[model samples]
Every structure is written in C-alpha cells, then in structure tokens.
Target: MLFEDEKTNSEIAKMLHIGETTFYKWKNNPKFIKAQHEYAVYQFDSALPLAVKTLIEILKYGKSDKVRLQAAQIIFKRAGLFSDNGNPELDKAKQRKAIA
Candidate 1:
C-alpha cells in the first residue's frame, strides 16, 4: 500500500484496514522511507522506455513550435550538450568522460 502511487494516506489506510494515524506512523519510519525511495526508483526505471519514447514524440511532432523547441532543449540538456558555466573546456571534459 505504501508503494502504491497516487493514493492518499486515508485511502491507503482504509485499503490496508489500518488507521490513518498508523499509516502516518509507518510513513515516518526511516526504513519505510528508504524502501519507498527504492520502490520509486524501480517504478521510474520500469517506465523509462515509455518516457523516452514520449519525449522523442513531443520533440518530433509537438503542436506548438515553442513546445517542440522546449522538448529538443530538454533532449540536448539531458545529453549534456550545454554546460552550466558556458565553458568550452568543461564541456570538452564532459565529452571526454562520455568517450571514456
């Protein structure tokens, strides 16, 4: 229940047959928090293929020019084409890391 997405505390508690306060208590536990983070990463990894496909689709055929450009910019940013300090030396370092 804790790993379920888009579920409110009260809703999850009801589904689990537990009190809302108990649900909150479990949510506050450190181990539970760590497990939640792991589960979220697993879920994201599982959805990554579809997410990449959607981004590519938007970059290719988005309705507005601005939207398409934004999508392209996101792709370039993720690909590390732009550097934060606008330093060519730093960009070359990153390119070398990618090649290595």
Candidate 2:
C-alpha cells in the first residue's frame, strides 16, 4: 500500500485489518521482509544513499554470483541505465564466458 498513495504504517495496518502490534510482527516475517526490502528500494530517497551503497557492497562481495548480479541490476536500473531497449554491454557480457 506504500505505492498507491504512500500509506504509513498505521494506514496499512488499518487497511489490512490488523493491529499495530500485528503489523510489527509481520515485519519480521521472511515474506514480509523480502517485500519490504523491495518496497524500500522502490521508494528509496537521496538520504538513503549510504544504505544503497552498503547493499551494493554486500552484493559485490557476497558469496553468490546470482545475488551480486541481482544487486548490480537493481543499481543499474535505479541509475536509469537499464531501459526498455536493454543494455548492450550486459547483453554482450552475457554472451561471453570468462576463462578461469
């Protein structure tokens, strides 16, 4: 509900017919955590640059290449580079395999 009109926590709780306590509890749920994380990214503001940077670092150094790629995609999209026409560099990179 944060997107439609940027509803607050209380508003969301009322809309979902739940108490504030219940809503807080839901915040700790794994599914809710994932959704909230995405929502936070979508609604991110300039003041959140540090948090974004931290996430990028985690993605860059994290164990999973998949996670790192996902983070890179998010960062690129947020920076307005990933467009409807797609990214040429990304396409080319995907077509080429690294020799290790």
Candidate 3:
C-alpha cells in the first residue's frame, strides 16, 4: 500500500479499515520504517534513467533557449559544476552592479 501509492495516513488507514492512531503506530514501527525508506529509495533510483533521458532530450531539442539553459543548469548543478542558486538579494545586487 505504501509503496504503490502516495496516500496520506488517513487515506491509508481508511483503506486498511483501521484508525489513524493505529495506522501511525504501524507506520512508526522500526521494520516498517526501514521497509518504507528502502521502497522510496528503490522508487527514486528506478526513475533516474527516465529522468536522465528526458533531461538529455531537453538539452538537445528543447524549443527555447530558456529550457535548454535550465537543462544544462540541472546537469551542472548535479555535477557540482557551480551554479548561483544563491541569495536573491545578492543576485539583485549583482544585476544592479552589472547594469551600472
């Protein structure tokens, strides 16, 4: 139930014909938590191949320069290749200085 769908605690409890407190108790069980984390990691890892493929397509054939730049930025940031996703006020200051 947890791995297959992204359901809220309440929804999952209702689906299982249980109360929310009982659901939380089961959710917080150590084995259940471990399994949950493992399942989430598996899901994330499984998606990476498709994500990389789409990112490559965007870099190569995106219609707009803005989108291609965004794709390149994603690749660079993931590679620790430096990006300025920094303080907005600092960015504005830099922009003003450039204009001046």
1-77: candidate 1 lDDT, tens digit per residue: 55766887889899899998988899999999999999999999999999999999998899976667667767888
For residues 8-98, write the lDDT of model 3, one tens digit per residue: 8789999999999999899899999999999899999999999999999999999976677668768878999956777979756744564
Query: lDDT of each structure?
Result: 0.81, 0.73, 0.84
For model 2 the TM-score comes to 0.37
> What ranges in model 2 sit over 4 Å off?
1-47, 84-100
| Residue pairs in collision within model 1 | none
Give me candidate 1's TM-score against the actual structure.
0.68
Candidate achieving the largest lDDT: 3
Better of 1 and 2 by lDDT: 1
| Cα lDDT of model 2 by residue, 1-100, tens digit | 6445598889999999999999889978899889977877766764488878787797779677666666776777788986536477865565343211
The parts of candidate 3 lying over 4 Å away from their true place are 4-21, 85-100
* Candidate 1 Cα RMSD after full superposition onto the native fold (Å): 7.6
* TM-score of each model, in listed order: 0.68, 0.37, 0.66
